[model samples]
Target: MNYLETENNTKITHFVLVGVSGQPHLQIILFMLGLVMYLITVIGNTLIIVVIILDSRLHTPMYFFLSNLSLLDICGSTTTAPQSLINCLQDYPIISYNACYAEMGISLCLGVTECFLLSVMAYDRFVAISSPLRYMVIMNKAVCLGLTGISWTIAFLTSVIPMLVTPVNFCGHNVVNHFACEMQAVLKLVCSDTSTSLVLLFVGSIFTLVIPFSFIIISYLRIVVAVLNIRSTEGRLKAFSTCGSHLTVVTIYYGTLIYMYVKPQTRESEDKDKIISIFYGSVTPMLNPLIYTLRNKDVKGALRKIAGKSKA
Candidate 1:
């Protein structure tokens, strides 16, 4: 590996991020847009975290998971967006090799963690809606903590293992076409054999995407069946209302993610690909907290109360 940095070293030491679109005229526009987005994402997610912390009313399992998810989104978007915002205004955005790897690794960890966390939250909803009698027992403190712990562990392992498989020293091209250090984009820059690494990526995809997707599907199916069995129409309405926000968020989050990853990488146009990446990496995080809070009356009321107290 030292040879990768020696007198004979021809391998690239850093990568240039092509970063979104490049119209000299659009740079200022993009920088302003990204700055607004980054601020909204940070502040919105921060409010969610703070709400969950400051309000004893939000200490429920659902809010507990939501606070964790909010924190992850803040970290996730910040890892990619701030740099992209700066790069949008600059002539070049250069990322050192080690920094690239670290960014890629951490982004993967948080991204995958969020995926599984959403699925886990979906399950929590399933338990609450389908088995109200047993909900507390099922999602007790120990169980919630255990699930959170496992999600983080799986996320770290999924990220680190794929990173380990990718060669740190590649012989040629060092520019990442995308704004951020996604595994797919970085691995495309690898000069060494990536067939094995791609296969492992597929495996990681199964653990990160497939397994969580399966859990979400099964949980929802059962919840639907359970809801239908309720004798009163009001009971069913109430049940669905509880799940409505989560279902909407899951649809948005997973739908964008699927568009980003599941498509044939070979066929996507650069601009189209960047658009999809932006939705997942930059836009969705900004929207998630708002979606959860605005669509739910309880959260809205809580926020109003918090605001009122502050003003008072």
Candidate 2:
């Protein structure tokens, strides 16, 4: 390990975030773009949460879970985007070590929580379609809150444990090769052997990503079967409609996540990883509310009512 020796013989306290681009013009462009996306993400997710809360028609298990998902999206984007945007505009692009770790922890927690929440949502859809009469009874308020609590608890534990246990020795190299404090990029700076941390991270990824993804797939498969069994055309259409927005969000969310984490990392792939991270962490949140509202008639109606009331 190449430890640094300062004038007073101490280690560096901060890290340089080598953002997406080194060129000044490119950095400015990225800053502007990131800012726009961040604003949209916050506003859009907030709107979803507000709509769900204000509208009595949306007071069902589905919308309740959707509101939770929106909140997670907001938190996820907030964790990375603000720091990234600031870094983009700065000449030194520096972050304190503790701040970087905090960012990583919060980002991971929100992301893992979203993964489990999405699977729970898939189950909600399955129950709604597979057993319509008992949907309310099955997914009562207590059960919904319990499921959300479990997701948050598991996510926080998984995220915090590895952060606390993992050994991160920056040595002399304190430059991170991406905008945000991404796990892989940060790990690359470690001077010590990171085999244990790597193993733990892999196991955590399996629990947070692969297992939940498999559950979503299985739930959707059953949903497809049930939807097909509907005798009437309108019935089949309604069932598919209910799952379509969720399916789209899941595909986009998991696609970026799988590409970012599941693939082999190499020198050439680092840039690609950052881009995909931005997609899931920033762009996806902004798009989610649009996907749900544009596709969902109930949400549209609620928006209309809200707008009409304001006009009056």
Candidate 3:
């Protein structure tokens, strides 16, 4: 089908999403996998939020930030995973132009928010380890709330310009070469000049990806120094233990994101890129709560408590 202009003069009404694979057998496998991941992502993240809220022991700055991260993971996975799964079942998966833009905007906002949240979490760790006596005062309730609010506000604002500008310019092309309306994938479908959008996206990427990553690195460096200064091996191990989960999460999240967005794209790498995107978008969210719960004694204890209470 050819692209047609709407009454309002918009060039594209709908877009066909060429999902990760074209083969029917692969699509079936991908759909089942995506469905399973989506279920786990929602259930795991929701469990984290519930555990933190219900467990008095978890009512701390760290878990507070963790709850927010869980929320982001939920939103992030919901933004694309369901649609991707649905597309896998359809012969020609199409999304309305408006819906595509909305998906792109929300996904971008959530992605940026996660970046800021991770950096904030890193800083929280730094304060906790480096200045234990003052950690409470430093990461007070007001400050924690402020940090969370700032992350959401800045992320939404950063995505607003691109969301407003990009859809207005998509002219002839109406086929997105991915499972969902990923920003870059959707942008690739626009026939009109997207130089301004691309530039703005680059600037946003710098703030969202580069700056937050740098902050995480700096915070970890200080944390490492502080851990090294501890007198005993037990003390050092305990300090590092607290940081282990966050570092693992940060490495996985940023590593995949950098590879997905920071690296240049080529035709040959598009399929691999889509696969990586799936890993980060759907799989990572599902893994986050598992990572935190498995590595952190507090979370496990809370889960056990909750399980016992239910049994009682």
- The alpha-carbon lDDT assigned to residue 304 of candidate 2 equals 96
Index of the highest-lDDT prediction: 2
Write down the worst ten-residue block by lDDT for model 1. 1-10
Candidate 1 collision pairs: none
**Higher-TM-score candidate among 2 and 3?**
2
Superposed Cα deviation of residue 210, candidate 2 (Å): 0.6
Candidate 2, 104-139: lDDT as tens digits = 888888998999999999999999999999999999
True-structure lDDT of candidate 3: 0.84
Question: TM-scores of the models, in the given order?
Answer: 0.91, 0.94, 0.93
**How far in Å is the alpha carbon of 41 misplaced in model 3?**
1.0
lDDT of model 2 at residue 174? Answer: 78
Pairs clashing in candidate 3? none
Candidate achieving the largest TM-score: 2
Residue-level lDDT for 80 in candidate 1: 80
